[model samples]
Target chain A: MTASSFAFEPWANTHQQRIEQVLSGVLPTDELLPERLHSAMRYAVLGGGKRVRALLCYAAAKLVGTDIIAADTPAAAVELIHAFSLVHDDMPCMDNDDLRRGKPSCHKQFDDATALLVGDALQSLAFEQIAASQAPQALIQVQVLAQATGSRGMCGGQSIDLQSTGQHLSLAALETMHQYKTGALIRAATMLGAYSAASTDHALLMTLDQYSRNMGLAFQVVDDILDATADTQTLGKTAGKDQAQDKSTYVSLLGITEARTLVRKLHDDTMQLLSSYDQAADPLRGIASFICERSF
Target chain B: MTASSFAFEPWANTHQQRIEQVLSGVLPTDELLPERLHSAMRYAVLGGGKRVRALLCYAAAKLVGTDIIAADTPAAAVELIHAFSLVHDDMPCMDNDDLRRGKPSCHKQFDDATALLVGDALQSLAFEQIAASQAPQALIQVQVLAQATGSRGMCGGQSIDLQSTGQHLSLAALETMHQYKTGALIRAATMLGAYSAASTDHALLMTLDQYSRNMGLAFQVVDDILDATADTQTLGKTAGKDQAQDKSTYVSLLGITEARTLVRKLHDDTMQLLSSYDQAADPLRGIASFICERSF
Candidate 1:
């Protein structure tokens, strides 16, 4: 099938289910030792989020002709990192959101201390999953994910955000923040997925990375758009939180119209970047389009 | 030198300086982007602690005839995990201590959010260091460290500690908690160190682990003793905070005399466990004795 003829829904749904299964298999059960921490970790990760990172991973793996099963570990690892970030970001000292994925935040459902440990445990579990993988490049996967998750990546972005709260940011500064905060992991997901295929070349990795960079930015711009326009019920999180906290976002810096324009550009760039590849890259294109067009 | 003749103080001082140097090199400086987070990470990890975990790792590596330079990565990695745990545990929601290693805690020195990010980033950095290692068994090291740090290990033990606060725990239950919390990582340190040696045998790993298990519990038993008997000036932390929090500790459960007795027993067991090994195990014995006899 051609890229345009590819059915994105089935692919997305299948990978989502696959990632959920893998995550469930890897995560400690409530029946395990330290039942409360295990339970809260499950509560935070098992039933929520769009699993977009996992989807990106699977799609990138498919581009390199990797079996869907081969993508499971990295996909699950990236998603765990995502879930841990959300849990910690919602804590009182951070964003302080009570709602996440239409449920009480981890700290709200469990106590703050349990939530803290849950996040910490999940972060380690993510690396553990990668380390335990049978893949030859598992160590590389760990390094990529770790670099993306640590100071120079997601955490760095959040720190910049925290420092910039209640202050205005230039367009460059805003993009820099989101690039580290969201874009780093988004790129990591695709990089990890692509790496799963042993035959994947350096050029393929670079192209996939560029595509993910644009897609990652598009994802954030769309998030800013939805956060400004959608209600809490529709968003499954505390909407307008950025504005409420006086946090500078795409919408705040460039207005909704300009934010939408940026998403369109990023979406176009992402699709064009993948155009050289065959139908195997269709899922990535579809996901990019979805990022640009999704309402909530 | 024979085990009995080993000069632990000078050896420890040298290794301590070595780990600090490695940590300083690995940690991002304040000059890096997201300057504050990098600064806080450096602050949280550098110039602090006994470096007991790194020492254990180096000693274990020595026992396997691994070069000290080869042990650097895993040694730094385990210590990074230790430092990260301290930063998080000292947060307001967990132990809520204002002091760590005789200085203001990370959260106190740089705000709670920075401290939280510092811990999270440090954990990732630890895994990154292991993943980036040139060691062939680096993946195994990652798995070992991640398992020891996750829900079934340090975090689990902390969760149990949080839940057991203000409630008495049986000596068995308390030992189980310490096994996970402290013993797991201590065991991991030796495992990682031993694994750095290409020829380290399973038998060697198992024996070293048993030694670390006793050494770890003895370390905590000593901690409890110090908390009960030493002043803030000596301990360099908030002495009596455990009692103030109504937390269950060895001193609280077994009393000072019994706690000291447990340390002595653990120390004896540790030394006996190493009796089969030659003088290369001297550092391990030295550390065990220090853990047993330390007033701070």
Candidate 2:
């Protein structure tokens, strides 16, 4: 089904409120931190946006029989990482966008220094929160999250993206970049949720890894399509900004039709993988669908 | 013994070589990673700095019964964190300095974007190296290192530093800034080393913590002194840059004489705490002295 056909309006409405409540409690309050840093963090995180990563963490945890309360740390952890990336991406040296989530980007609203510090602070806070969790497996989960977000993962991907500007990239090169930059943490989110429940099925973990890889790429492919087709207002940021910057995207590398087809194939593969699990995997299925169908 | 009399030259020389060697190996040459990212990570980390933090880690671990080779990950981790901080701190929005370690800062030598990515990459690499270590206690040590370097630690301190610039900070506020900015990782270095060796003594850890706190402030106090007394060539980076920017420092707040007295007091206190340990703690004592005596 197309994004328009899904009608997640009511579900999204409830999810947004749940995410807001969790974030407000999870994040250190202004009284506990520098007001400027706290405000910048809240600005990027609490501002209206799809809590896709958080949902993935919660869904994966629930699938593994972990309660939603137990999912809060990982959910907040991924969201913090997401917020940090956005803040840094919007810096003048990177995407240089003035806006994000329909509001002024961190660097634009505050000074670049504040924005940089905010990103740095949020990044550290993510790890701190994860490490400080009372969950029995919190340390292991935190370590996993760190690896997914660190050098061999997301940040490394960003480094590749920065250097890849104006350079021709093979499909393999593009995939490598996305795998490191975006896919790693997305995959880690699911893995973390499973690990949170102390799930120890090696076969299931491998299957989930494969499913996450497909979903991660599918997520990026859809993002590329939306960037090309969506309006700025609809996207809540500058649409086609990637094209404007001449950054290579899946849709640019392959035509929009091919990109869409690839996502469809990826979605199908992911669905097939999920079928091996029971009905408890419904949230994982829903998330994959949501990712494929997101409007912005 | 006085720092001038202690002779840290050999330690400095050996530690420098060790840090470079460890850094060179940490970033895998595997074709899986983008060449540009590998290059940026190398540029940001290799062949830079005095390796003070790395030396501290190695020394502390050695003191606690771990071999220097076994201490490599924590050593590399702290140095990488230091390198990342330097890279970002030199950005136009932060200290805006053009020179670092007597060479062009990363943002100046490479483009600002490359420098930013380099910093980001190095930060991730720090954790990656720690997490990937083969040490028996790798997981726990890595978690400790991450917490110390992240928010509520180094990054938090950086935010406070930026906020406190040009403001009249009280002695306690200044100490808090130093604790977060420089102290967190310094303390972590010692703790990581001890943790790596599986030292579970609560009293010993507390003593090391106290030693680290005093040494951390003493190091910063001496830094302020060196900035005032040393030249640019000798100090490596721009000397007196802090004073030039009207940043609040212990010397600025308490005068050089009082700052000197404070360092002496901290040094004595650190030594007293360590005295409870045996001669195996000589390196720790040496490090504490080295913090006070380093001309630069």
Candidate 3:
């Protein structure tokens, strides 16, 4: 809308605002019983972050020729899962980070136990989002989301990433790790949109999986590059902490320029896949480029 | 059946073995990728507990004339949720317990990150278990479980327990705490059984809820009593840790003798509720008594 290099900004902004409203409306307020846990859930989730998963979900739904409402529930669920994972990952025994999205991490603002419950409860809320939806394929949607986020996918990737920290990781190993960790959920977001459709286009969903995997890897590569080079204020987190902590990252292994090229290459691959579709795929193409290009 | 005081032992033993088989068959083993996380998940779950939740689920289903297969899915799902919560609660930032089920805790056996992922993936798998089931009430089953375990229920209780540590808790406060923390899942265990039926009897479910609430409270009171009096070897965990951590318990506030009477009263209330049901309710009545009376 503002005539930036990206064409998807206005559309993404609309979806972001809509998703935030949905999340706000759905989440129980802190004023209720179990006030502390509810407050922490809201605090952890409502704290600002890029709603990349939601945007992707909306885009995928549009490409599949489905109602936006069909996409909303799964999108919200994916975002909650993301938020919960962040809360757990930032705890004292894990990343131990005190800052997230320019705000105190959940474990910092709330105590560890409260933060732990926040994450746990948010995860249940995520699944409830899908279950509560009136979508025809709601059960399949739950299965897809569950498989993507579970141990063999995102969780498995996290295990590999944790093990690979400070170890000499080959490029192939890094790709596999990101594929499971970030790529799996990103892939799930896209599949959720497709599954939300009354009748999914199997061929198109397969292609979208490719787009998602590439986009997910591109996202992580950009993250590592930003972590290596950006300032804390620019990144809204403690930048360079990965390098400081001796974690092996794309930037650390291949340098920033090469990582940037990889991002562009992945972007081109995603866009090329989108080129075959009609105008409905524009949102996805725009989002693919925007996510790889955006600062946050 | 053995000549034990509980007639459910024959039935309970059957369900327990079946549940163990289901769990063992379903969990991704250590031989697969991300071996440590998988191993820790199995170690934490397969390590051994009384399988009280599974027994309750099966008993509830039997009362409503549902197939055992209908109960197995939810039974395994609830147990997985139980196991996941335990892994996270045992982390250093939470209860800081070192021993669980006579073995090192998840985080102690594996690194913290692996343990965290294990809990997360287990939760996903739990939802997946329910979603993958062919049961007719699969959606309601998920909702029942998600509501029971989420912020307003089990996680909420944990937050209160964390907050109440070292504080002088009123008896009502203590009841509310246990009702949420432990009672919710145990309650879910029963509700899930009721939901798993093809056509649920709402009145019976309502009665079962009362039975579950009283049984859940009685279970917790016995737990507190055992914590104060049982040895760690018998309990398969660090006994008396509650008092060591200054957490309030029924035994702590009421003294062991009074707490025992409360247990008996709750037990009588639960048995009375079961007595009104048909002959099919025998397993539930027997298990309720066994859960209240078992030393472990």
Candidate 4:
């Protein structure tokens, strides 16, 4: 297929709907036991985001010649984790933020304690769902997901970010932080998708790891770019939050021009890794461009 | 073996040592990339409780003709989840306790944010360890553990508990709260031990679950009795905390004599369930008696 033939808007929208449905199906209903916690869990997950992680999961499934159905549970698992992290990070003791994705944060919408339980329960639910997958390597997939979200992965990233608050960090240090914090899960999302096809090829896994690393970092770089340039309404989150919180970001470390330049380089590197695949990898390429170029 | 031949003092001590060693081996060292998070995790898990959960795991393993070695990883995994829950529950927004296991709470020892990360990271690490288990039934073990720890299990219990704070609870409501909050994980600990041996016998699993629930409720009933009758120094935690917090308990709702009777009755029921097993279940019987009758 030619480059001009590839389209991402329709692809992303379709994946988002499917992902939302998958989440709704798996989450505990409010009519059942512990309705408030269930309600908050649903509230945190439903009615938001571009479902970029799910899209990546689907796109990676395509990379291995599988359909989106194969990626459904893993995709939802990754998003549940992402949503849980957001709920915790927005707590008053953490980021002290009141808004997330243009609405009240979980703690604000619910209560502090409910929000805390929401994160804890959601994390367990994600593992529970993934472990229930019929994929042959289900145990291995659980390990992969767990490792990415563990202390050496996402939680570790957030720890350093908290410790490094109000302190200037070198570019190497910042990269390491984001690598553990955000990049860990993004890479897991893509790898989980790739593994959802139950393929055991080590070489493809390595290539996908490289592809995911580049893509994950590129995603963050673009986010920093948007933070500096986009408005709150466009971003759907507090724009320029990094500057206000005195946290280091790509735009702050490097000027806007250099930050934008880094995004392009990472974007090219991501595409280069995906080029080994046929046009079936088009969604992967499309998402790379989409995430990097989106105004919000 | 005769009942008189069984002893819990040596058995529990040996299992505690073994569980501690496994925990140290699995937890990330503070020398690693995320030193603070690793440190907090270690601090939260090591040098902890009576290892009742680990003992239950080993006893359950014994029921299925497996030794403590077969039970090591699962035992440590349960303890880790237990430890993480305590850390989060001790935060200012939750129970706001200052001490756990006779030491400063995680938030007091570290900071609020570090405590949060410790809980988050420990939960992930627990899954990582269990998923790495070589047991034939590892996936189901994960599910059982996840469900026990999920919203409808531990977290759900905690949510209703937070909502019930300062409100009068009926005897049934209090029992329901403890069933989900404390009983769920206790039952999981025993079941994971059963599942650890990869046993497919439904009847035996059902028996063990019944034994666990009885033992779990009895354990809490004993706790409430102690809270009402013991001192902080002996309990290693604040005594009369529930009463002070306006939280209802078995002792608060049922009076001391009735609560004690309930504890004895539950203990009898637990023993009756274990009677169906051979002398191989002596350790289970011993632990149940010890939990219900221990001065501490």
Using all chains and alpha carbons, the TM-scores for the candidates as numbered come to 0.98, 0.92, 0.95, 0.98
Cα displacement (angstroms), candidate 1, residue A182, comes to: 0.3
Show model 4 residue runs off by greater than 4 Å: none
- Segments in model 1 whose C-alpha atoms lie over 4 Å from true places: none
Model 4 chain A, poorest ten-residue lDDT window? A1-10
User: Residues A1-296, candidate 1, lDDT per residue (tens digit)?
Assistant: 34678888888788778888899998988998899999999999998778999999998998888988889999999999999999999999999889999999999999899989999999999999888885878988999999999999999999999999999999999989989999999999999998898767889888998988888888888889999998999999988888888988889888888888888777777777777788888998888877788833
Candidate 3: where is the Cα deviation over 4 Å?
Answer: A1-6, B1-6
Best model per lDDT: 1
Tell me the deviation in Å of residue B258 in model 3.
Answer: 2.9
Task: Compare candidates 1 and 3 on TM-score and give the better one.
Answer: 1
The global C-alpha lDDT for each of the candidates, from Candidate 1 onward, is 0.90, 0.78, 0.86, 0.87
User: Candidate 1 lDDT, tens digit per residue, B28-124?
Assistant: 8899989999999999999978999999999999988899988999999999999999999999999999999999999999999999999999999
CAPRI tier for the interface of model 2 = acceptable
Over the full model, what C-alpha lDDT does candidate 3 score relative to the true structure? 0.86
Worst 10 residues of 2 chain B by lDDT: B1-10
The C-alpha RMSD in Å for every predicted model, in order, reads 1.5, 3.2, 2.7, 1.5
Model 3 agreement with the true structure over B31-107: per-residue lDDT tens digits: 98778778888987884888999888988998889988888889999999999999989988789889999988889
How far is B65's C-alpha from truth in model 4 (Å)? 1.6
